[model samples]
Structure formats: structure tokens, C-alpha cells
Target: MPTFTALTTLVGKDSAEKLGEAMERLTPEPTGVGVFEIEDGSGLWEVGGYFTESPDAAGLAVLAAAFDAKPFVVSELPETDWVAKVKRELAPVKAGRFFVYGSHDADKVPVGSEPLLIEAAMAFGTGHHGTTLGCLKALDRIAGEGFHGRSVADIGCGTAVLAMGAARIWPETVLASDIDEVAVEVAEANVSANGLTGQVRCVEAAGFGHPDLAAKAPFDLVFANILKAPLVDLAPEMGANIQAGGFAILSGILNEQADEVVAAYDAAGFDVHTREEIGEWTTLTLCHR
Candidate 1:
């Protein structure tokens, strides 16, 4: 079936969320509505809705005018198999010893390389993105230096790819957590797919808030591939959770934002061990002092 969408942009988060709630009450009501901040430093938030039937343009216009938002743009989206498209576009990624690929590329697993199967899904971190790729490489580098992670935690774990990567090399159970429940479910599925059901534990938590994670504190290594704001905010917590002389691999930072993140971690008693830049992203490996 063809899908239709109505999208509008507004100035503030509050207004955008209110507009999204209003869209839910429209005739032939939207199947789903979402409000997201546009991260271009524009202070703009995007409100959008998807529908199986054509959206009511008049209703959207009325809501836009009432909320002082831009005029809604309605469009009919062609029916397409998104999974097949993603499988076609996302080739396998190789970062040091780790190889990340979907089931379609199962035949391409190179011998002697640590294989990590991550099927395309609603969750993130397939290792194709620079942030994930860089983290994988940093993990490999740390292992190459003869560091064995007795306890590892992957904060904001998406598909649990990094957690699986750590599990592949070490015998200890790796903890993977994400704030989104759906992501935790997806991480569990990925862990099972990689035959890591017992090796990686998945949890739903923000940062280190979960009881299970708190019980497993002072990790020898931690992975937090989240944005700069949360990474900075979690600096003190990260320092507390990581053992002295342990490591933290952090990414999801723009190239220009690396220095600021480094400063935050530095103040939290971390010293930069290594830094890698991939495209527009930068990943840092920090040693807890």
C-alpha cells in the first residue's frame, strides 16, 4: 500500500510536540506521528506523521497556522521494500579484526577475521556508520595492545554489535544497554543471532541507571557511542563506573566537537589514549586515570 506523510517544521520543542499531538486527532488519523529536533544548529524541530490513507491537508494547514509552524507539506510515498533496499546498499564493513555484515553477506565472511552478524533493522549501529566503525577499530586496537576486558559495558548499545565484538574476543559476559526499549529488544535479537545469548546481556537503561549495570560497576572497558551532550554529561558517571587504568571508547562526535568532549573527560580523570577521525566523525579512546 502507498504511504502518505505530512511534515512541518517549527521553532521550539514544546510547539513541535504539541503540533504532533494535534496531528494524531486529524480525520483519517495518522498511523504514526513523530517529533524530532533538526540538529543543524537551527533551533528547529520537525513534526511529521505517516498515514496509510492520504493525510488531510486542510487539517494539517489549520494545525500549522494555529501553532505558528511552517505550512505542512504532504506527499505520497511509493511502496518499496525498505529492508531489501538497505541490504542492497549496506555492504559488509571490516574494522581491524571485526567484520560486520547482514545475513545476505554470510558467504563473504573472510577466514581468520572475527565475524559479527548484524541484520538491518530498526535499531542502529551496523558498523557501517563512521561512528560505529571507528569504535570497532578502537576496540581492536586496544585488544592488540594486550588488554583483555574482564568486565565490559556498552552504553547506548544499539544493535549490540560492539558488545558482541567484545564478547567474541573475551570470555566474560558483556553488558549492553540502551535507553530505548525497542533497541534493547533489537540488541537481544542480535546477540542471539550471533550465538552470543549467554555472552552479552541486554538491558533497557539510560547511561548507567539500571540495577544490573550498577551491580557490575568499575568496568575494565566501556563503550559509549552516543552524542556529545550525553557523553559530556556522563563523564563523571563514566569515571566512577570505570576502574582506574581502564578504557572508554567514545564516539558520535562531530570532528569539530572532539576537543570539547576530550576536555570534559579529561576533567573527569581521563587522559586521551588515541583519537581517530573518519569522514565527519571522531572517535576517542580514553584511559581512566
Candidate 2:
């Protein structure tokens, strides 16, 4: 089956969302509509729709004009076996004490490093990305500084690689949560694949909203490898959920956005302990004050 996508960008979230709603009502209705901020400090929001068949170009044109957005660029996506393609393209990544590899690369695990199996499919957070890599490095640094987590949580834990990394070193049961249900399922599968079924608990939650996460509050450490806006929105709750003198390892931020994120967390009662830039992303370790 062929798949088609129509993409456009607008200035405001309200316009993007309204355009998404309008896309849903088009003939040959979109299978899915997604609206998201561009996140590059562009101040633009993107509205994209996926369709099983070719979309109505005229309808898209009208919506774009109505929303004051860029003209929709429609494209047909090739049907490719993404899993095999990813396996062929993504080499195993080494970040600090962690060696993250796909099952296909099992033979490459280094002797003394912590190994985490993350098959590249359906979810995010392979340690190859700078954000994930930086978080792993931060965790390693914290461990080297003689801190061990009593209880930890990874918010927006896509594949639970970070949680698994923490579990590999510490005695704590790491709770991994994500807003997407499919991501939770992926995390669970990765946990099992890593033989970490009892060590990492997976839940579907936005931030710390899940009761299981809330009950495990005042965590000794927390990892949130999600983007800027959510991290900022999560600051107050992060302050409340982390124990006094506990730590937070945060990533998924562009280097340019790190200062704003730091200010937000500082207002929420955290003091930046360390800052590391990997490629274009910045990872921060902060202590709750």
C-alpha cells in the first residue's frame, strides 16, 4: 500500500491545530494529523497529515490559506522495510559506561561496559542520538562522583535505554514512562530484551502523572530526555518529585535553548551542577535545591 503525506508550517499553535482539525474533515480523510512546534527557535508550528491515498490538493490549499500557513507539500513515501534499513545504517553506539547495540550487533559488546539492547524499531532513544548519548554520559559522571540512585524514573523514556543503563549499574528498580502507549510497549519489549524485566518498570504517562510514578515520588534521581517545552512545563513537578539534593539528568534540548531551560529549572528550585554539549544538543545535570 502507498502512503502520502501533506506538510505545512504556520506561525502559531492555534493556527496549526485548527489546520490539523480541518485536514481531518477533507475528502480522503487523513489517517493521522500531527501538529508540533518546529523546536529550533523558529517560532513556527508544523501541521502534517498522513493519508492512505492521495490527498485533495484543493482542500489543502484552502486550509493553508485560511490558516496563513505555507503551501502544503505533498509527497508519496516509498514502502521500505525500515527495521532492516535501520539495522544496516545505525552502528552500535558507545556512550560512557554504556554500550548500546541492536541484537544484530550483539558480538560487538565491549567487555567491561554496560550493554543495552535496543532494536531500532517503532520508538525513539537509541543511544546514537546526541541527546541520549549525553544523558548516558551524565549518568556515568554522576556514578563516578559516588552517587547511586535509591529510586529513579525516566520521563518520556522512549526505548527505556537510559533506565536500563541505570538499572545495569544500580540496585534500584527504574520506572520508565512515556506519553505514547506504543512507546511504553516498546520500552517493555526492550526491557525484556535486555533481561531487565524486573529491573525497569514501563508505564504510559505524560511526565509523572501516572500513579505508579507519583507513588515512587521524591526520587533520588530522575532522567527526562524529552524536548525543551515539555521540560520547562515539567520543571515545577520535577522540583516536587525529586528528593532534596537529588539529581536530574535532562536532554533533548538544542544548545541554544539550554539557558532558557536552565532558568526555568532554576526558578523551580534547581541549580545547574554540570553542562555538557554533544554535537548540537546540550545535556544538563541539575541538583534540587
* Runs off by more than 4 Å, candidate 2: none
Clashes of 2: 0
Alpha carbon lDDT of each predicted model: 0.93, 0.93
* Per-residue lDDT of 166 in model 2: 95
lDDT of 1 by residue, 1-289 (tens): 9899999899998999999999999999899999987755688999999999998878888999999999999999988888888898889999999999999999999999999999865425888899999999999999999999999999999888899999999999999999999889999999998999988999999999999999989899999998887899999999999999999999999998899999999999999999999999999999999
Clashing pairs in 2: none
Instruction: Name model 1 segments beyond 4 Å from true.
Output: none
User: Where is the poorest 10-residue window by lDDT in model 2?
Assistant: 119-128
lDDT of 2 at 218: 84
